[model samples]
Target: MGKNTQDGTPGSWFKITIPCGGKYDKTWLVNSIQNHCSVPFTPVDFHYVKNQARFFVQDAGIASALKDVSYKICDEENQKISIFVNPSNVPYSVRYKLEPEEMEQLKLTMNKRYDVFQQALDLQRLRFDPDLVDHDIDIILNRRNCMAATLQIIEENFRELLSLNLSNNKLYGLDGLSDIIQMVPTVKILNLSNNELNLVWELNKIKGLNLEELWLEGNPLCDTFPDQSTYISAIKDCFPKLLRLDGQELSPPVTVDIDTPYLIKPCKESYKGSETLKSLVLQFLQEYYLTYDSGDRQGLLGAYHHEACFSLTIPFNPEDLAPSSLCEYSKESRNMKKLKDPYLWVQLLKHTKRDIVCALGVLPKTQHDLSSFVVDMWFQTEMMLCFSVNGVFKEVEGRSQGSVRAFTRTFIVTPASNSSICIVNDELFVRDATPSETQNAFSIQVPTPISSSMSILSQEQQEMVQSFSTQSGMKLEWSQKCLQDNEWNYTRAGQVFTMLKNEGKIPEEAFKQIP
Candidate 1:
């Protein structure tokens, strides 16, 4: 009864119903119904007086095909026969009959090699029957020659499944797995161990899943790592919020900084600066931008240290043409390749002041809006201060009509002998503004100016707040709040921070600073 047809297509049983009360030709109805079905089937025995007809559908997922056709039994009532197939209530000969398109989709998904799905279908049927007690439908180690299509079938039908054990199934890769991950987000525990996966990068397709535990032991990918510690890095990178991997319980990082002062609604341009470092960076940027815009080669001669390196990368938009001077720039331009060039390396290694001057002079004149600036500064080492400046610079005196380009410049400032700081390493990236960004270029809504004295703090007190914020890993606004809350006493603020940190009440967002 389970044998395939001449074309190697599988068969399922379905019951066809029609009205017998009216003058209907039973022979014609059966012949027409069989021809109307999308997949060919053989009708089982049935009398003309008896309206019930059964068929062995030779093709999968054709139960819904019978519903698409219409046969008028009589004009008085306009009777329409609708075919309904229930998988659980099939005749004694047919063990499993797919219900409709939805259930057929699940039944058709099982790999045909092992026929383990025949067992899975029975298990699924029992789960849906109200008379049966609830049980787990864990599809483990069936070795059904599984593939991405198999997972897709399971995702459509078994979304409520919590644990799935597909280990020892000879699964080579997880292509098209994102569909399952998206469909079955409720899957918390998954075991895919002892498979042939060669890289963990395949797991990156799965995003926004609440996966608590994942198993990939005995895979070729695991063998590539020297130890569990090395492999865990890949796992953590792909699954940022995962709690467990390969049966090992992982501890999440303490992202909340307890010692950091808290600020509220801080200004974008505000810097959590140290007294000497912040002033030096701000002053350097102020003078640098002015000289950059002046288009004078001599003005930029003193900004770089003797051993400094400078490189600019332009991420051009496909729709926007590169300037005439920067003709080689493209949408895919990156400094990584340019830095490796021996010719460019020689110029940067020599740190020729004239070369730096000429490089800056050849570019179109730019007017950097300091008010739109967003600054982030941190000390990489005791002797080195690193900072990144992000803002929009308008290209003026060009063929284009003052197109705005968003720019980011990262600088490693080391203290010069004369108490001033010069950039030791300067990396710059410039890109055309997106449509939304171009529209919102000047539409930034700043915080309403506060009348509180916190806005009117002395330069020294303001620097103190910045210092506190930097040292404590807190936001500038939250640091202001702490200073205002503790009457500008660093000692009292320290105590308050300790209390909050001990109680695990510090907000995680305070530690995040946009670059």
Candidate 2:
């Protein structure tokens, strides 16, 4: 009994059950529960949470005032059963959970109500109306400037109502809408289809409000700016839960109209490089983003050959089936547009023993003795020498020997002829733009003893590190995997800065060591 332990195991259950029905008035917090954790649920149970709604069908008066509010309920097979048909008979205790989307839709709908409320107030329509009625409203229907007063009074009676009807009117901002959205535990269904307002900011904060639909159409200033598409895209990218957009059609993607070189706008010095290639790239992106972004493929690499010499690389087991790859780029190198019709160049030369292709995992994850091998890349018809850019070796655990690693990159390779490489699939259209015309090899300072300590990045090394974002994740991705334990030295800092600056994402501050 000196060192004893208790046995631990999962307990058995007699039965497993979940509800399944499709009714909006079910008053079940389905999405809230689902979003919180969905793996444990059966689909049938989730459906029941959404469809079997519990809403008021009738109401009753307390002080003989003749108040009546009716509620309805549906069963598993979609049959409507009345709840509060007779105002006096109330259920013992009803179960209901407010959804987040419903709250959002309610929030948007309140904006419409506020505007309508303002209009009715301005018009001075105080009595129950026959003509000015836009939709069903309980207390403040067709009243002149009575929204605030009506809401004040209505808040005294019913509590669950989160949305109001104030469609089609003039309101400066959707104020107090946040209170309704935040305070109301249960509210869904908002309709803000018509109004004269701009800049709705506060409604975005309702963390888990079930907001499925949003109607912000019929606003004049919504499209006042030409760059609205960029703005919208940026916002939607941030708010992933936004389900629907019931506004005026979002602006279409735009292409740079560079024909009016005479009508140039102000910009920084970065545009001095090949603007034609940039424009082409922008056009390609505008045309292809939807089809491109849907899958796990890497993103677009623009002018990589002309500007960065960053060769794309793939890691594979060294079973004699993978192509050697490396990158060539430089952070210190100034951005210069080189080629006019920039395109990827892949040679279909026959593979040879000397054919050089960069490989990964051959280098250990830990830093090791660095070495260089001038691969006589064997290709069809001729041989070309391929050099590893900033090559380094690493010693990994559980592995027998150390591995080699260097970025696949852009460099001056002396090809045998203009016909030395041909596109196996797309050679017919590739013009014979020799290296002198189309290529931008890495900028190497000549005749100087190699500053092994200076940590100067070749154009290829810079490009490989810079282009790492699209594939690996971000600047810190591959580095995090590779540099788990090592401390950053001055050379490492220099190399890190060179990679970041070339990427054009982080500023020069990234080059400095962390304090």
- TM-score top scorer: 1
Off by over 4 Å in 1: 1-276, 316-334, 337-350, 442-515
lDDT of each: 0.54, 0.30
RMSD of 2: 24.5
* Per-residue C-alpha lDDT of model 2 across residues 118-143, encoded as one tens digit per residue: 22112222222333233232223222
RMSD of each: 22.4, 24.5
TM-score of each: 0.31, 0.24
Tens digits of per-residue lDDT for model 1, 1-515: 12221333234444545544123333355556766767665543232223343433423366567655545222335555555453323332233222234234334334222234322222222122333222222222222122333455666666566666666655564533444555667767667788777766556545445677888998888989764544665576556566788887765421211122321112244546344445555656765775576544344445666457666787534465545334423322344453556665454432444344445555667666554567788545546778899988666676644677788889886655544556678777787776766655532232344657456889988898888888778866677776665557676566556545554656766554758
Judging by lDDT against the true structure, name the best candidate: 1
29 in model 1: Cα distance from truth in Å? Answer: 99
